[model samples]
Target chain A: GQQVMQIPQYQHVQEGEDFTTYCNSSTTLSNIQWYKQRPGGHPVFLIQLVKSGEVKKQKRLTFQFGEAKKNSSLHITATQTTDVGTYFCAAHGGTSYGKLTFGQGTILTVHP
Target chain B: EPEVTQTPSHQVTQMGQEVILRCVPISNHLYFYWYRQILGQKVEFLVSFYNNEISEKSEIFDDQFSVERPDGSNFTLKIRSTKLEDSAMYFCASSAAVLAKNIQYFGAGTRLSVL
Candidate 1:
């Protein structure tokens, strides 16, 4: 079975602080997707990385995919209270079709 | 903006009882999935449904678990004999395109508690 491991299971950051979370998969992935789940809410899609060694940004958030396509990272600059949530990296196209293997997730807590 | 809808936001059942979690995916979506999350634990994938059949399933989906598209608008997951470990939040997700490239929209989830 393929496994996706995430680092810094929990993060506590003050307002305007920067935060970064890393994710690694046991197997290479064709594409990796990032999702955020706010407190007491469902997971919402954020962004997806498809190419090897690709970098994409959404406002203050930056996402990077490793050259091998087996690792990824998400960095947030100047965190805000609304950034408090659990971030998960989901992988697809390793050995299954129409299926996604999600990492354990990194919970981010931004304090004002 | 379409959303996946789930019924019975919470369910309480005795051990060994049967339970069914229902979901209504986005109208134009073609792929469906079921995942579960224990309190304070990671989300675990259960199964993926496509083309009126199961395309993939995790080891956790055994004979005790079954999924069915009973109608044009309904997808159901049935647990034959529930156990304490089955207590968790079950989420139903759907995507408009092939999974590898499409994003899945998840429901609020159904919290199942087995006493």
Candidate 2:
């Protein structure tokens, strides 16, 4: 069975601070996707990285996929009150079609 | 922008009663899935449905669980006999296709509580 692990289960920061969450997988993945779940809301897709050693950015958020395709990271340049939510990284293996193995999310708390 | 929609934002039932959770996935999507999350826990996959049949299911989706696509738009998950442990937020998600490049869109989940 494949498992995805995320580091820093919880984080707290003031506005204008930077935050980063790391995700690692026990098996190599075909692609990795990042999602954000607002408090009491459904998970929303943010970005996806399919190529090895790939990087993508959306405004203040930067996402990277490792060269080995076994890990990924999401970094926020400056935290805002609106960024308070749980960030999850999901991986799909070569044989898993669209089924995703999600990591234990990193809960980010941004204080104004 | 179309989004997945789920019915009965919250449900309450007895321990041994049966319950059905309903979802209407995005119209153009081809893949459907069910996931559950306990309070303060990670979301766990339950089953995946495509072409009016189940394609994949997790151990949690045992004899007590079943899925149905009765029509072109509705996908439902039925629990034969609910238990206290069955309380959680159940989410329905859909993807345009079964490719690594496709991203899933999730609906606001149905919260179920078994007393």
Candidate 3:
């Protein structure tokens, strides 16, 4: 079985603060993806990391894939109330036709 | 942007009753998938359908669960018998391809409550 483990299950920060969440997979992954689920909303795809040691940025968000492709992290800068949501990391292995194993998620709560 | 649409935002049934969750993926997308998430838990993969057949499934997708494309525009998940443990949010997702880098668009989800 494949497992994606995410840390800091819950995080609360005031506006203008920074936050980061990390994910580790028990087995090597071919690629990893980041998604955000707003309160009572579905998960929305944010970005995907494939190449080893790759890093991608989306506005105030930065995503990094470990060299081994077994871990990754998502960092949010200067959090805002709009950033309140659960961030999840999903992984795809070498096999399987793009089936994803998702992490429990890091729930972010920002206070104004 | 196009989105995946799932019917019946919520479903409540008895422990041994049969239930079906329906999904209509983006018209142009070729890959369809089903996932489940218990309250405050990770989203778990149940099955992946492509070219009208299942390409992958997790251990959680046992004999009790089945999937079908049904027609040109719909993908469905049928639970032969429900259980208290089966109560969760079921999401339908679609992707353009099986590649690692493609994005998967998810539906709002159908919250199942088995009593």
Candidate 4:
């Protein structure tokens, strides 16, 4: 079994402030994926990191995978009110048949 | 863009009753999955289906739970005897087979409340 841990269960940031969330896994991960779930909505796929020390960005959001491949991070710059939601990091092992184990998630609240 | 669809946005049932949640995955996707999220919690994987058979299932998908692809378009999860613990939001997701990274697209979910 694989365990994924995320830090800062809750985060409150003023609009235009920056926010970051970290995710660590108990075992080596083949790949890590990030998702965003809005209030009363299902999880939406944001991006996935496959290579070690990989960094990808989507607009104001930047996603990074640790060099060891067991950790990852998501940083949002100049957050807007629309960034209010929960960000989750999920991963699956090499043998898993597409079964994704998700982290507890970081709840982000952007105050206007 | 196509999307996964779920039926009955909300369902309420009594304890010991049987309930079925239905989902229609993206037509072109080859893998289908079901997950549950207790309010304010992370999404937990339940089962994964491919080629009309279950490829993998988690411990939570025990004897009380079963999945079936009765038709080409519908995938269903049935709880034989529901308990209060079964109350959660059930989400169905689908991913394309061509990609190595299975990016699952989830449906809005069906909130089940067991009284």
Candidate 5:
């Protein structure tokens, strides 16, 4: 069985502060996708990382996939109140399509 | 952007009763899947459907649970004799294809509470 683990299950930060969440997998993944779910809302797709050592950015957020393809990270710079939500990392294993194994997720709370 | 839509955002049913959750996946998508999340827990994969058949399913998707693509536009998940443990939010997702390169789009999800 494959397992994806995320660090800092929960985080509380003030506006203008930086936050990061790490995800590690027991098995190598073909691709990793990031999603954000607001309180009492459904999960929304954010970005996906495919190549090893790949880095992608979306404005204030940066995502990185480790060289080993077994880990990934999401960093938010100067977090805003709108950034408050649970960030989830889901991994798709080699040859496993349309199926995703999700981590426990990191809940980010930003205070103004 | 096209999005998946789920019916009955919230459902409450009595034990031993059968319940059906419906979803309309994005048009032009060929793959569909179902996942569940219990309160305060991680999202768990339940089953994946393609070509009118199940491609993969987790241990959680047992005989008690079944899925069907009744038509070209609708997908349904039926639970026979619901139990209290069945209380959770069920999400319907669809992707353009069952490939590692494609991304899945998820629906708002249906919250089911079995008493």
Candidate 6:
């Protein structure tokens, strides 16, 4: 079994502040995916990281994969009230096609 | 934009009763999956289906749980005997192809309350 650990289970920040959450895996991951779930909604695909040390940005959000491929991070710059939600980092270990092991998720609350 | 759609946004069942959760994945997607999340908890993978068969399943998917693609468009998860611990939000997801590279799109999820 694989395990994904996420840091800062909860975070509350001013609308203009920055936020970062880290995900760590006990076993090496083939690829990592990021998902966001709003207050009563389902998980929505945010981004995926495949290459080691990969960095991708979507407007104010930035995602990074560690060089070892065992960890990843998501950073949000200048968060807004609409950014309130739970962000989860998921990965598929071994050869388990689409069986994603998800981290506990970081619940972010942006206060205006 | 196309998305996964699940039926009956909420379900209430009694322990030992049978329950079925339905989902309609994206038309062109090749991979379908089921995941569950307890209130305010992380999403947990239950099973993944491809080409009309299960590709992978987690330990949580035991004999009490089953999956079926009854038709070209419908994917369903059945709990033979629901238990109190089975209460959770079940999500249906789909991916285009090559699970390693593609992103999975999730449905709104069905909140199951087993009493």
lDDT of each candidate versus the true structure: 0.92, 0.94, 0.94, 0.94, 0.94, 0.94
In model 6, state the lDDT of residue A69: 96
Q: Write the per-residue lDDT of candidate 1 for residues A1-112, one digit (tens) a residue.
A: 7788999899999999999999998788889999999988788999999999999999999999999999999999999999999999988765576677888889999889
Every prediction: chain A TM-score = 0.96, 0.97, 0.97, 0.98, 0.97, 0.98
lDDT of 1 by residue, B43-102 (tens): 889999998999989999999999999999999999999999999999999988774688
Per-residue CA lDDT of model 6 for B5-108, tens digit only, reads: 99889999999999999999999999999999999899999999998889888889999999999988999999999999999999999989755887889999
Q: How does each model score on TM-score?
A: 0.97, 0.99, 0.97, 0.98, 0.99, 0.97
Model 2 spans with C-alpha error above 4 angstroms? none
lDDT of 6 at B97: 79
lDDT of 3 by residue, B1-115 (tens): 7999999999999999999999999999999999999998888999999999999999999999999998999999999999899999999999998887778899999999999
Cα lDDT of candidate 6 equals 0.94
TM-score for candidate 6, residues paired by index: 0.97
DockQ of every predicted complex: 0.76, 0.82, 0.87, 0.72, 0.83, 0.82
**Residue B91 in candidate 4 has what lDDT?**
99
* Candidate number with the higher lDDT (1 or 3): 3
Model 4 residue B4 distance off true place after TM-score fit, in angstroms: 0.3
Model 1 residue runs over 4 Å out of place are none
Tens-digit lDDT string for candidate 5 (A47-104)? 9999999999999999999999999999999999999999999998676657899999
Model 4: CA > 4 A from native: none
Residue B66 CA error for candidate 6 (Å)? 0.8
Q: Native contacts recovered by candidate 2, as a share?
A: 0.74
Residue pairs clashing in model 5 are: none
TM-score of 2: 0.99
Clashing pairs in 2: none
Per-residue lDDT of A8-68 in model 2, one digit per residue for the tens?
8999999999999999997889999999999999889999999999999999999999999
lDDT per residue, candidate 4, B3-113, as tens digits? 999998999999999999999999988899999999988999999988888999999999999999998899999999999999999999998862447789999999999
Worst 10-residue stretch by lDDT in candidate 6 chain A? A92-101
